[model samples]
Target: MRVELDEERRAQLPPTWQRAFDWAEESLGGRVVAWEAQPRWRPACFFELEREGEILPLYWRGARGEWHRNTRPLEREMHVIEVFERNGISVPTRFGLCEDPPGLILSRIPGRFSLDTATDEAHRRKVLDEYLAQLARIHSIPIEEFEAIGYRRPESPEQSCLGETRGFERSYRATKTRPDPMIEFQLGWCHRNVPKDRPELSFVVCDAGQFMFDDEGLTGLLDFELAYIGDYAADLAALRTRDLTEPIGQLGDAMRRYSELSGREIDFGVIDYHTIRFALINPLSVAGMVTDPLPQANYVQYLAWYVCYGRVGLELMAASTAVELDPPSLPEERPSRRSVAHVHLTELLDPAQAGDDGERAYQLDRMQRTAVYLDRADRYGEALESDDLDDVATLLGRRPSTWQEADAALEELVLSSSPERDPEFIRYFHRRLSREEALLYPVLREQQGIAVPPLE
Candidate 1:
C-alpha cells in the first residue's frame, strides 16, 4: 500500500516535489511506500519502503537546524560510528549523508525502544541490566589506537567536573525563577568539597536513549556524537538520570554488574555526584521542547524525578562527610582522606555571609582555625580552652555588621558568582578552597574581618 503524507507535513517539504505522494515515491527508490510521522517525534517523518521484493525504512530528520545540525562534532561522531562498525559492532549502518539537506542516512534497525512500550517487571529489569552491560562493553573499547582517527580526549575529569559545576552556576543565575537556596547550598558544598583529579578515561556513547533492542536481544547502542575520552562515571551518571521508576538499589545493581564485568572499580561517589549534575543541567536543554501542554506532563514527571534524585544524591554526599577517598599510600606517607569538614563549616555560615557560600564556609572555617591558633599565640587562655571557638568564629564572621550590608553582599555574590562571568575563577576559587582550605581560608577570612565572639 502506498503511504500518503499529510497535507500539513507535505507543506514542510521543499517545492522540488509536486505532491506529497510524489515526494514519498521519489524518496523511496522509486517504489510505492507507506509513511507516517513517527509518534512522539513530530519533526521527523518515517517511511516504510517496499519494492519488487526488498523492503527498507528510512527516517527523514526534518530540516530544523535547532534539533538536528551538521556540525564538526556530529561529523566526528559519524567517524567514530565507522570505527565501531569496523569492530563488528551493530549500530545503525550509515547509508550515506543525505544529499538534499545533508542529514546522515542510517539503515533502520528493527526493534521497539523499551522506553516506548510497557514490559513485564522481570523483562524490564533484565533489559535494564543488559543495556548497562552493553554500555560497559562500549566503554571498554580502547581509544588510544583510535587517537589518530580523529578521536579527541574530552577534558580531564577535573576540568569536566569544574565545567559542570560552573555550568550549573551559570544556568541557575540566568533562570527567570528565583534560585533554590537548597540547590545553591548544595552546589556550594560540592564546589568546596570535590577535589580535582585526572583519572583513567574511556569512550562513552553520549546518548543512551538511542540504544535499541529486538526480541532476540540487545541490538545495538547508538548515538556516538557525544563520545569522547572522559570519565566513564560521567557516562554512567547520564544513564542514571533517565531512571525514574526504579529504586536506587536497582541502579546500584547495574553499576555492580558493570564493575564485575569490566574489572574496574566503579566510583559510586563520583557517579552519584555526576548524576546529580546531569539532572541539574538537563532541564535547560529540554525546556523549549517541553512547552506543549501534552508533552509538558511527561516533561514535568521527568523533571520532578531529576530534581528529587539530584537532591538525594547531594544529601548522600553531604551526609557521607568525606568528598574524596584516600589515594594509595606512598612509601613515605599514607594518602590523606579529604574531609568535608570545611564544607560543613561553610554550610553553617552561608546563611549569613556575603561571598560565595562555598568560599565563605571555607574562609570562615579557616579563619576560625587561625583565630584559634592566633588566640593561643596571644595567650587568650579562655579562647584557646574552648573547643567551640572555631564554630563561634565562623558564625561571627558570617554575621552582617548591619542588615543592609548582609543584603548587599548576598545580592552581589549571587550576581557575580555565576559561571558566565567567571567560570574559571569560580572553579579555581572552589577548587582552591576545597584542597587548600588551611592555606586559603586564613587570608580570606582576615579580609572579611572574621573575628572570634567573646565567650559568655
Candidate 2:
C-alpha cells in the first residue's frame, strides 16, 4: 500500500523540498506510487514507482537545511559515487541529482544494511571479508584521482591528520550557543594530540563500514557524504566505531586482514588517536542541535548520537591516557506528578498501535520516543541537575543552582585552564555525560550496549 501523507503533513514541507520530490517524479517520467521518508538525522526518503513496466526503487536523500551542512556539497557526493562506480568499488548507482533542495537521487541498494543480518557464521564472515576488502579497495584509489575532481589533497602529514577535524571544530564553534565542557575539553585534547607518524594520505571514507550485504556478499557501499583524503588509519578507526553497532566480527582481526590486503602496517597508536577523533564528530555535529534544535530536526536522533557516540569519545580518551573511569550510578527514581500523564501519552502514540500504515507508524515512533524522553526528563532531570551542580562545584569551588550556570562556569574553567588539568576535566565531564546517558536511557536503550572495539 502507498504511504499517504495527510494535508497537514504535506503542508510542513517547504516549497523547495516539495519540488525536489516533483523533480524526481518528473525526471523518471513516473508517478511516485509508494514512498516513505527515512528519518535518521538527515532527510532521506524511499520512493517506488513503475517505469516502463518495471518497478524502480529510488532514494531521495536531502539535506537538513542550509543551516546544517555536510563537509562537501551534494553535487560532490554524486561525483564521488561516479568515481567509486568507475573504480570497481561497489556503491549505489546514481540516477540523478536534485537541485532545488540540494539532494541526490540514487538507486536503492538491494541487501541488508549490516553483516550481522546473516544468520549463519560463515555467511557473516564471507560478507565481512568482502566488506573489509572493499574498504581496502576504497583506500587503494590514488589520491590524484580524487584530487582531479576538486577533492582537496592534504599538503602535509599534519594537514592530512588534523585538517578535517579542525574544519569540524570551526563549524561547531561558529554555531555554538552554550558552553559544553565535554565537547570543549575533547576538542582541546584532540588538538593537542595530532598523530605525527601518519601514513601518506589516501581517499578514506571518513565514516567507513556502512554498506548493504547479503548471503552472496556486499551489495553496495552506501553514503559518501564524508568521503575525503585522510590517513588510512582514520578509516580503520572509523570501522572500529561502526563495529560498536554493526557487529563486524573481531576488529583486531579485521585490521590484520585489511593490512594484508592493502599492504600497510596497522598503526595502533594512530588508530587510537583517530578513534577518539572520529567519535568526537558525533557530539560536535549535534552539540548546537541538541542545545537548540530546529522544528523539523530529529532532536531525539541528535540526542542519541550525542550521548552514545559522545561517550565513546570520552572512553577512548580515558583508555589512551590510562585513566580509570567510574560511570556514575543512576540516582533514585522518584516519579513526579506528570510521569503518569507522560506514560499515557507515549502509550497512545506507540508505533505498534499504528498497524499496517508504515508512514503513520514512523511518525508515531518519533512521537513516542519524544514522549519517553519527556517522561524520563520529568522524573530524573532534577536529580541529574543537582548532581551536575555538585560536579561543577567540585571543579570550580562554588555550586551553581542551575545546570546552565554550572555549564558556563565549567566551560570558562576548561577554556582558561592548562592541559595539566585535562584528566580532572575528563573525569568531571565523564561523570556529567554519564548522567545524561542515564536520563536519556529509555530512548537510547538499544544503543546502550554499544562499545568501541579494540584496535589491538
Ten-residue region with minimum lDDT total, candidate 1: 447-456
Query: Residue 101 in candidate 1 has what lDDT?
Result: 42
CA lDDT, every model vs. true structure: 0.48, 0.80
Give candidate 1's error at residue 44 in angstroms.
2.6
Error of 1 at 117 (Å): 5.2
TM-score of candidate 1 relative to the true fold: 0.55
Candidate 2: regions farther than 4 A off: 1-18, 64-72
lDDT, candidate 2, residue 53? Answer: 81
Per model, state how many residue pairs clash.
2, 0
Q: Write the per-residue lDDT of candidate 1 for residues 1-456, one digit (tens) a residue.
A: 234546564565435222433544555455534564432221344555566688677654433222343445556656777878876666776644443343444566667764435355566556566676667776777877457678665556665454344644674466424333234544565565454664677776654435666655567666675565666777766666544432222567767777887788877767766655555454433333333323212333333333344434443343344443221111221122322444344355443464433323443543344333332223322332231223222323564444345434444554445433233223222222222222222333212221111111
Q: How close to the true structure is residue 298 of candidate 1, measured as C-alpha lDDT? A: 32
- Using all chains and alpha carbons, the TM-scores for the candidates as numbered come to 0.55, 0.92
